[model samples]
Each structure stands twice: as C-alpha cells, then as structure tokens.
Target: MTDTNPIPARLAALKTMSGAELKKQWRALFDTEPPLFNRRYIETRLGYRIQELTHGGLKPETVRRLQDLGEQLDGGNIATRRIRTDLKPIIGTRLIREWQGTEHCVTVTRDGFEWQGRPYKSLSAIARTITGTRWNGWVFFGLKHHRRAA
Candidate 1:
C-alpha cells in the first residue's frame, strides 16, 4: 500500500531541494526574512518548522516544562528556583561567612576575588584556607546549598 502520511515525503523533499527553492520555502513557512545562516541550518530549521506547523506544535504543558528546564540551565536553583549561578555577582559586592566565631568577608572583583586584602582565583580556595578543608565555593559562601532540603 502507498504511504498515506505526506509528512515523510515533505521532509525528504526538503533534503533534495535546491538552495533557492529552500529559501522560497523558508519564506513561505517562516513569513520573514531568511536568516543568514548556512544552507544546512536553514534546511534543518525549516524541516522542524514545517513539521511544527503541520503537527500544531508542542503541548502547553510540554512547553512549560521546557521553559522550566531552560530556567535551570540559566542558573535557577531547585529550592528557591531563583538563585543564580556563582559566576555573576555585581562587582564590589561583599560575601560574608562566619568561621570559628570570626567574620570573614569576600569582595567580588573584575578578575577574581579579594579576601582579607589578598586575591584568590576561586571561593573554594578561600574557604579551604579559612577552614583547612575542601569545600564547594558556592556552598561555602551561601550561593548554593550543599544538600537539597527534604
């Protein structure tokens, strides 16, 4: 029996179409200026776009789940779902930690960190020197929690 699903044929035709034909198809499918990306990129994106248009795209719940995953990848934490990654704190911001009843302060700098008038490459290094043990820099400085609360 002949294949009744036309989507497979449409996708296959995308692979065989000439560059100019692909550009025309892209304009029709996307209704905007074709991106300056290479032909392969155009082909792959067009293929997906065509399928999405025909199949009506992802469900709302799936889209929300993807957005949540994207937020995590961009530095959202599990507990608060708002804590950003450690690499980005404003310059001159002070991070404080208490050890053995002594207050220690770390200042964010353009290049690295400044603690106790000395420059350090990472917060872990500062934490190790202060406590004499290995520690995750983010957790040590309270940017991240070492364990997720149950």
Candidate 2:
C-alpha cells in the first residue's frame, strides 16, 4: 500500500509531474476516484449567486437560496452586515473631536465641541467650514456610533 503520508521525495516527484500524469497519479492515489470538491466550487457558486442578485431582479427563490447558502457560508457575518448597513445612518452623528494643545477629547454637541481646546459646534458645521464633506476625518462604524480617535 502506498504510504498515506507522502515523503518529501514523493511530493517533489508529484509536483514535477505533468497535469495529465498528475491526474492519473492523483486518481491512483485515491483508488481511481477524483477529489470530491475544492475551494473553486464555493467561489464559483458565490460569484454566480452575486451575479444573479445584481443582474436579475432577485427572484424570491433566488433570494431564499442566497440566504440559505449565506447562512451556511458566512458564520453570521451576513446578518451582521445587513444590520450594520441598516444602522449606518444613526452612526457618526456625533463625534469626540480633539486637536493640538488639548488635554482631553471634547464632545461635539450642536452648539460646538466642549473640551480644553478650540471648539466646534456640529460635525457638519466643522466639515463645511474646515473640510468639504460631511464625513471628513470621521471614522464611523455601525449605528452604535463609536467615535474613533482621530
């Protein structure tokens, strides 16, 4: 019987073999049965489902299949993303702004930031007067609104 744990020389020989020869040897290794599945199948199916969802109108059956497969595939991450996207608007509404020569971070209320430094009232006001966009210098996560350190 061939050793199930291949030695380094055997592994090197297998690596050097041609594709057709490798196929033959691989089948011979498993008594002529091909490998059952691989990562390619999962990637291909995911791509196909994404394409269907994006290109097609997302039929109910397809949506169900996608959800089922997603549950099996994603370890609860899919549900989390859905929840996060839903909650994104509530996040980053307020932030703790800090600047140079500040001892502590300030809470940015409607009137302006409150701290031992230069203050700003609102993030939008700050963004408008300081930067161009409403989301400038703000690192926002889901609706929980973690005001990250800048």
Candidate 3:
C-alpha cells in the first residue's frame, strides 16, 4: 500500500540526497548555515524542523515541567552534586589491612584490584586466599560496615 504521509516521504528522500543538497535543505529549515556536513545530522534536524513547523513546538508549560524534573534529578544543588561513582575512591588508591598477623596491601586499578603484584578479581578473593575463609570484600577491607541501621 502507498503511504500518504508527506513527512515520512520527505525524510526518506533526505536519506538519498547529497551532502550539498542536505545542507541546502538545512539552511532553508533552520535559516542558518548548517553546523556540520553529516548527512544524518542534517536529515534528523530537518525532519524535526519540518514536523515542528507543521505541528507547533512544545508548550511553555511542558518545557517548564521538563526543566523542573531535570533540576530535581540533578539534586537541585549543581555545585555540590557529584556523579554517583565519584563517591568511591579514585583508581590507584591503596587499601591496607592486617589479616592473620600479616599485612596485606591492595591497589585499586581502573580494571580491577592488584594485590602483591598479582591481579585479583575482587578483594573478597584476596581476603579468602589470605584468611582461608569466605568474607565480604568491602567489609573485610573496611570499605563497608557489617551492618547499618537502615
């Protein structure tokens, strides 16, 4: 069956157009010189512009609601907010502990932990190997507590 949507038909034509042609269309839609020569970028922006012109842009209330949601997710305090992973010690941090009257040192790496010049999958493995028993790596290394109130 033949599709009757002009927007889809125009977008499909955009896929086959030359870079120069896409840039020209970009200028017409955006009223400015295109930023880059990427065909996909031009096609996507142009397609959105076409649809936006046909069916008006988002309402002001909708935009305000979206911005409020973004602020809440960002913790509402941008200066003090940090990415979740930043709470952990950085790579190359050294964790030292005494197990069975012997000192064990482990170095944090980007990929995994390194102990005594040997690579280990986790601190629990090194702890088990050192103590001859199962242990929670974080607790064994004092990175976490045995239990929390919550």
On TM-score, the candidate that comes out on top is 1
**TM-score on alpha carbons, each prediction:** 0.49, 0.21, 0.45
- Order of candidates by TM-score, top first? 1, 3, 2
lDDT of 3 by residue, 20-112 (tens): 898888889888999964667678888889889988889999999997986775557553244344654588999999987889999987645
lDDT of 2 by residue, 19-120 (tens): 555556545543554445453443343344434444665679989999888676445564333433333234224444433443333354333343345565
Count of backbone collisions in candidate 3: 0
Error of 1 at 20 (Å): 1.2
Which of candidates 1 and 2 is the stronger one according to TM-score?
Answer: 1
lDDT string for model 1 (45-81, tens) is 9889988998889999999999888676644434334
The backbone clash count of each candidate, in order, is 0, 4, 0
- Clash number for candidate 2: 4
Q: List CA RMSD, all candidates.
A: 14.1, 15.1, 15.1
10 residues in a row with least lDDT, candidate 3: 79-88
